[model samples]
Target: MEKSRVYFTDMRTTENSNLQKKLARLIRKAGIGNIDFEKKYVAIKIHFGEPGNLSYLRPNYAKTVADTVKDLDGKPFLTDCNTLYVGGRKNALDHIDTAYLNGFSPFSTGCHVIIADGLKGTDEVLVPVSGGKYVKEAKIGRAVMDADVFISLTHFKGHEITGFGGALKNIGMGCGSRAGKMEMHSAGKPYVIQEQCVGCRVCAKSCAHDAISFTDKKANINHSLCAGCGRCIGVCHRDAIKPADDESFDILNQKVAEYTKAVVDKRPCFHISLVVDVSPQCDCHSGNDAAIVPDVGMFASFDPVALDVACADAVNAQPPIQNSQLKEHWNESGDHFHKVGPNTNWKVGIAHAVELGIGTTEYELIRV
Candidate 1:
C-alpha cells in the first residue's frame, strides 16, 4: 500500500505569520481545497474544552479553518456531540454554553457552535458501518450526519483510556450521540450516585425505557430495562449519573475507530491535528495536567489514520519533559502515550482503522 500524505508546520511564525495563519497554510497545502466546498454544509468537528481544561485547541485555529471554508463558498459550523460523561457538555444547551465559555462563540470562530446531538442527547441518526466489527450501526448525532462534508480539528494529546486522543478519537468518539458514546465506552448501563441524586426524578423523566426508579429519595437504574440511551446522564443537575467505563481499552479504541468510520463514510472529509498543549490526559478533563513533552507541530491529512500515526510518532520521538507525566511513567516501551497511559494500546485503533480501510498507517510527512 502507498503511504498517505500528512502535512506538517511548526508553531513558530514570522512577524507576518501567526499560528492561525500557518494553520491555514498547512491545511491548504495538505489538500483541503481539493474538496468541493462550494455551497456545502461542512461540519468542522472539534472539542470545545471542558469548562476548566486549558489544553484544548483555541478558537483561533478553528476560525482559520472556518474562514478558509467560507472563502471556498462553504457553510461551516463547529460541532461536537454531547459527551457520555456528566460534565458541562453532556447536553446541547449546557454544551453550547460551555463552548461559548471556552471561546468557541460564533464571533471567535467565524462560525456557529452546534451541539451535534440535540438538547437531551437523544437526537441521533443511525449510520451503518460498512466494514464494522465492533459497531454495526453507529448512532451519530443528527447534525453531524446531516453535514455534506466533515472535517476534524483535533487537539492531539494523551488520553487516560485510549492512550491518545487524535483524529480517530475526535471523529469517532466526538461524533457519536450519547447512546453511541455509551456503546463505545461500556457494555453496561449508567448507575446513579445515590448520594448525589436529589431524587428530583429528572433522570427518570428522561429515560425512554422507564429504566430509572427512585427509592428512599435516591435513583437507581434498571440495567435490564435500560437501553443505555444516556439521556439521564445529560439531564442530571447534580452530576449524579455516571456512565460505566468498563470496556477494555483495546475494545474502546477499536470501537472508536469504527464510530469514526461511520461518521466520515461517504463524506468529503479532511483532518487537522494540533499537537500543542501535549497534555497528559484528555481535554475532557476539567483540569489539564502538565505537558508530557514539548509541543510538536500541527499536522493535516486527508487520511485520519495516517494523521494519527504521524502525530503519535512525532510525540514518541520527542524527549519527555522533566517532571511531566511522561517522565514520571517512563518505560522501556519507548512509546510516549503508552508510557503515560500504560494500559492502553493506541495502535489498536490505528490497526483496526486500516483493516476497515479507513486509511493506511504508513505515511509520508510533507513539511509545509
Candidate 2:
C-alpha cells in the first residue's frame, strides 16, 4: 500500500501566521481543497466538551474551519450526536445548551450548532454495511447522514475503551445517535436494575417502542420490544437501566468500526486531530485529568486511519508527564494508553476500519 500523507503543524507561530492560520494551512495542505465545497452542507463533527471538561478543542479552532469552509462557498455547521450515557448532552435541548455553554455558539464559530440526532435522539438513519461483526447496519444521526460532506474536528485524547480517541472514534461513536451509541457500546440487550428504579416513569416515557413499563412499583424492560437505543438509561435519574454484561471489548471495537464506515462510506471526508490535552480518558468524562504528556501538535489527513496512527505515534514519542496516569505505568518504550486501559486494544478499531476499506494505516508524516 502507498503511504498516506498526514500533514502536521507544531505549536509554532510567526508574526504573519498565528496558530489558527497554521491550522487552516495544514488543513489545505492535507487536501481539504480537494472536495467541492460550493453550496454543500458540511458537517464539522466535534465534541462540545461535557459541561465540566476543560480539555475539549477550543471554539476558536472550529471558527477557523467554519470560516475557511465559508470562503470556499460551503455551508458549515458544528455538530455532535446526543450521548447515550446520562449526562448534560443526553437530549437535544440540554445538548445544545451544553454546546452554547462551551462557547460553540454561532457567534463564536460562525456556524450553527446542530445536535445530529433529533430532539429525543431517536431521529436516525440506518445505513447498511455488509459483513460487519455485530451490526450489519449502523443507526446514525439524521443530520450527519444528511450532510453532503463530512469533516471530523477531533480532540485527540486517550479513551478508556479505545485506548485513544481520534478521527475514527469521533465519527463512529461520536456521530452515533443515542440508540446508535447503545448498539456500538454494548449488545442489544438492556435491563432495569429494580433497586435503582425510582418508578419515575421517565424511562417509560422516553422509550420510543413502549418497551419499558412500570409494574409492581418498578420499571421493567421488555427486551423483545426494546431496540436498545439507550435513551431509557439516560432518562433514568436513578441510573436504573443497564446493558447486558455479555458484550465484550472486541465486539464493541468492531461495532465502532462498522459505525464509522457507515458515517464516511459515501462522503468526501477530511479529518483533523488536535493532540493537545493528551487526557487519560475521553472528553465524555465530566472532568479531565492532567495531561498525560506534553501537547504534541495538530494532525490532518484525508485518511482517518493514517491520521490516527500518526497521532498515536506522536503522543508515544513524547515523554510522560510527571505524576500523570502515563507516568505511573511508565515503560520507556511501551504504549502508554494501553497500559492505562488494560482491557482495551485501541488498535482493533483502526485495523478493522482498514479492513472495511475506510482508510489505511500506512502513512508519511509531513511537517507543515
Candidate 3:
C-alpha cells in the first residue's frame, strides 16, 4: 500500500503564533489548497457538541477552517446530521439552536450552519456504495451529498460504541441520516426504556408508524408496528429510547467505513482531526468526562483512514493523564481507546476502510 501523508503540528505555541494559525498552515501544507474550491459548495462536516458536552471542538477552530476555504473561493458551510439519540441536536431547528448555544454562529465561524438531515431527519439521499460489503445503499444527508466538495472537521475522542471517534466516525456515522443511523446501529429496531421514560409522549409524536403507546405514564414501542426510522430516539428528552447496539463491534465498524465510502466517493474531500481533550466517550453525550490522555496535536490528511490511524497511534504513544478515567486500566493492552471502552475495537473500522479503498492505514507522518 502506498503511504498517505498525514500532516501534524504540536499544540505548543508562542504569543507570536497560535493554534488557529498553525491549523491553517498544517492544512495548506497537507494540500487542502490543491482542491479547486472556486464557487463550489463545500460541506465541512463537524459535530456541534451535544448541549452539555464541553469537549467538542471549539467554533474558533471551525472558523479557521471555514476561512481557509473561503480564501480559496469555496462557499463553505459547517454541517452535521441530526443524531439518532435524543439530545439538543435532534431536529434541524433544535440542532441549529444548539449550535448557536455552543457559539457556532455565522458571526463566530464565518459560515452558516446547515443541519444536513432536514427538519425530521428524513431529508436524505440514497447513495450507492460501490464496494460496500455491509451497506449497498448508504442514506446520507442530502445537503452533505449535494456538496461539490466534502471536508471532515472532527474532534478526536473516545466512544462507548466505536472505541474512538475520528475522521471516519465524523463522516460515516455523523453524516448518516436518522434512518441511515438505524441501519448502521442494528439489523433490527429501536425500543423504549420504560424506566427512563417520562411518558411526555414526545417519542409518540415523532414516530410516524404509530408504534408507541402510553400506559401508566410510560411509553412502549410495538416492534411489529415500528418502522425503525429512529425519530423517536431523537425526540425523547429523557434518553428513554435507543437503537439496538446488537451488532458486533467489528460489524458496526465495517458499516461505518462503508457509510464513509458512500459520502466521499468521487468528491474532493479533506479531513482534519484535533486530538485534544481525549475524552473517554463520544461527544454525543450530554457531558464529557476527564481527559484520558494529554492533548496530542492537530492532524490533517486527504485520506480518512490514514488520518484516523495516525491519530490513534499518536494517542497510544502518549501516557495516560493521572487520575483520569484511563488510569483505571491504562495500557492493559497498550491501546487506550480499547481500554477505555473494552467492548470496542477501533482498528476494525480503519482496516475495513482500507479494504474499501477509502484510504491506506500506512501513512508517513509529516510535521509542518
87: Cα error in model 3, Å: 1.4
Reference-based lDDT, residue 333, model 1: 65
Q: What's model 2's overall lDDT? A: 0.88
Runs with alpha carbons beyond 4 Å of true place in candidate 2: 195-211, 224-240
Q: For model 2, state the Cα shift of residue 67 in Å.
A: 0.6
Ordered by lDDT, highest first, the candidates read: 3, 1, 2
**Candidate no. 3 TM-score:** 0.90
The model with the greatest lDDT is 3
Clashing pairs in 3: none
Cα RMSD to the true fold for all candidates: 1.8, 2.0, 2.9
Tens-digit lDDT track of model 3 for 67-126: 999999999999999977667988899899999999999999999999998986878899
lDDT of 1 at 234: 67
